[model samples]
Target: MGLHGEELTFGVEEEFFLVDASGQLVPRGPELVFGTEERGGELQQELIRSQVETATDVCRTAEEVLGHLTRMRADLAASAAERGLRLLPSGTPLLPKSSHEITQKERYREMADRFGAIARSSATCGCHVHVEVADRETAVRVSNHTRAWLPVLLALTANSPFSGGAVTGYRSWRHVLWSRWPSAGPPPMFVSLEHYENSVAAMLRSGAMMDRAMLYWDVRLSDNQPTLEFRICDVAATPEEATLAAVLIRGLVNVALRDVADARTPVIVPDEVLRANLWRAARDGLNGSCLHPESGELVPVWAVLDELMAGLRDALRTTGDLEFAEGMLARLRSTGGGGDRQLAAYRTRNRVTDVVDELCV
Candidate 1:
């Protein structure tokens, strides 16, 4: 929230893997992270040298996000071309990659030293959306309202279907691998801002996470920014899809704020149930069954997605994002998703490079 009561600003942080000509993840992130001074957005190294991430400047419309995301990706892709590597905006490595080096940072070094195997093998990527909030209390309330729809978001953007040159039997295997972290998953519904703070203190005391930066929940209040950060979705296949996801996230927050202003309490499920649907989203994407957010009964993923769209329709319309969002959704429905496309390509010729070739474009 800003001076305007209807202010809607957001940002997207997307992680990507570097790969060679053969589609294997490679330890070449530095070439992009250090050479991205001219990129449209800020580029940073991830925990592993095989992964790099880009953070967009604050954006108020889908066009800004598209401009920044397109330019940043093109710049990175060009840099990779110069080095004979490819910029792979994937949620997980399609082929098995050798052990990668961690970035030379004190925090990364400490993580590798303390977490051991989990840190050694963690190279998954994701797209995190941060929607502006007026304060921490509002962010908490918005997070509570947004919790039930997390899995639908994941199902929509899932793009990690192959791993180690074989079908992994899961759309976003990155979600499965990322869940190996002790603190990563759906967060508990907090009763108040105080409750949220106390819970973080408890987690710190238990040593579940090294710091506030490691909250890792699907949605949480940002420690350094006035926004509610969503860590639910995988990096989408294209810039248009990413823009769709970002605006949808903003719509959810806008609707959540309306509910909060009206003194409406959100209907929340038990933590276990939320985690159940999350796992279902990871395993099936949109091709299998998922639980209804309210009924808790298994249903087709499209039904859940329709329910989500209905909930956000008013907010999206009010924000002038309805047409752009609908266009992207139609395109995705027509062409299918990145994960499905990869599986379809693999079905032809049984070649993983064929899948990589499609992504490289």
Candidate 2:
């Protein structure tokens, strides 16, 4: 909560893999612990020592996100160098490995204890951005309204073109891999926060979930904060991409909040329709059409994003970031994404090794 209760803020969590100098993802988690934890700036262990997550404190503006992410990246890069570790971003490994190891943290241990094989199979990395709402009610409202747009966001930020050491044939295989969990995918629409809580309580009573956090919906209201969290994106390979995605998320939340306040009708696609759109986005990226959440008609990826920006321009302007949003949109068009970059690098170097080098570099 900031002044006027009208503050639009952003917070992000990114997961990365610890790779060796030879550009291979090491399965040894505990061995990389010192290099990562010793850096000391919001660096935290993830489900395994081979994985690490770094987060930024709540920031009220896009520029602040840029500053924090830049500093965090620098810190992690330095820390990884000190201990013979490297950080790389991809949804999963293409090469495949033995055993899905969970980090030794109590929380994670509980996850494995509760979810069995689902928890063990969770080796994907992602980026979750938090956008502040006025209250829990608005958090639920925004989460519902934003569901139709989640797939678009996922598509735009698609960066996991490669897993282990091969092309995954999808722009975002992480989404599919994560969907295998018991409590994952797009959340059911709820009329109110109480309805959501009741559903969650029922899950707890039945032992279906360890707690609310396990919901793992692509979009959901955070239990401990007055914000809606968008967890559908892959960990961006570049700071510019991360910041751009954060700005777009902030703008989307603003658009939803305004619609909620004005009692405006939101074009919500059914859960099934939304799921179809997600599958399309994962398969096609910006190269094809996605099923519209409500209309069920195929829509171009860039068209959907452009329309979203148009609807939220006033909100972006209010945040004094209209230019920032436009700049990012242009970059997205010009640079494509990690997927495009990886494809290009592969063509030039003729190997997945070169693609990973380009991504990690």
RMSD of each: 1.5, 2.5
Residue 96 in model 2: shift from native, Å? 4.0
TM-score of each: 0.96, 0.92
lDDT of 1 at 223: 85
Per-residue lDDT over 1-361 for candidate 2, one digit per residue giving the tens place of the 0 to 100 score: 1224476877888887767766666655555544454323366677655677788888888888888887877777666777776667766643445335777779899988877777777777898898887488778877777888888888887777766576778888888788887667887888898998888888778887787877788888887877788898988878778888888888888777777887877776777777888888987775557876566778888888888788888777888778987997788788786666767787786687676677663
Angstrom error at residue 144, model 1: 0.6
Residue pairs with clashing backbones, model 1:
none
For residues 1-361, what per-residue lDDT tens digits would candidate 1 score against the true structure? 3324666889999898888888888887976778766645688889999888889999888889989999888888888888898887778887865547998889999988878889888888899998999589878888888899888888888899977778999988889999999889988998889999999988888888899898889999898888899999888778888888899899988888888878788879899988888889888886667888889899988787777888888788877888998887777777777788778888899988888888873
lDDT, residue 156, model 2: 82
lDDT per model vs. reference = 0.85, 0.76
**In model 2, what are the clashing residue pairs, if there are any?**
47-103, 93-164, 94-163, 94-164, 269-293
